[model samples]
Target: APFRMSFAASAKHVRVLENAGLVRRKVHGRSHVIRLNPAPLAAADKWLRYYERFWRERLDTLEALIRAEDKAATRKRSRK
Candidate 1:
């Protein structure tokens, strides 16, 4: 095998993906062709993007707060 896994292990992984609706397998005689089902992945991508933006906004706010605190500390140091 080009990969580290044996054929049986690879088949098990493919079966899991098929059960999850993440892949479709077509069998022709001795050959099996596996194709990815992109719908689930696309939905996951959309979900992740929303959270990415949410966290980005939250992090930006946190950065602004930290910077304000730092500036206040500097001003206090200058006055002392």
Candidate 2:
């Protein structure tokens, strides 16, 4: 149901997708069949890699903080 499309709207949507490098269209009879192009995905993947590195650094900092807190708690318990 989600993939259901009318020819006119599909043509417009396909044009936008092609412009964005997200898809390619080939003429098949009266219809232009859409083929997915991977260029946009590659770009997205590159963008996400930067964010992944950022999150990894943040997580490492959090892990160190957690370990320090755990060691402090252990020391306090031992004294009590």
Q: Pick the candidate with the highest TM-score.
A: 1
Q: 1-80, model 2: which lDDT tens digit per residue?
A: 56688868977987998999899888989876788999789999999999999999999999999999999999999999
Candidate 1 pairs with clashing backbones: none
Model 1, residue 44: distance off in Å is 0.6
TM-score for all predictions? 0.91, 0.64
- Residues 1-80, candidate 1, lDDT per residue (tens digit)? 59999999999999999999999999999999999999999999999999999999999999999999999999999998
Q: Which regions of candidate 1 are displaced past 4 Å? A: none
How well does model 2 score by local distance difference test? 0.91
Worst 10 residues of 1 by lDDT: 1-10
Note the Cα lDDT for every prediction shown.
Answer: 0.98, 0.91
Model 1 per-residue lDDT at 73 = 98
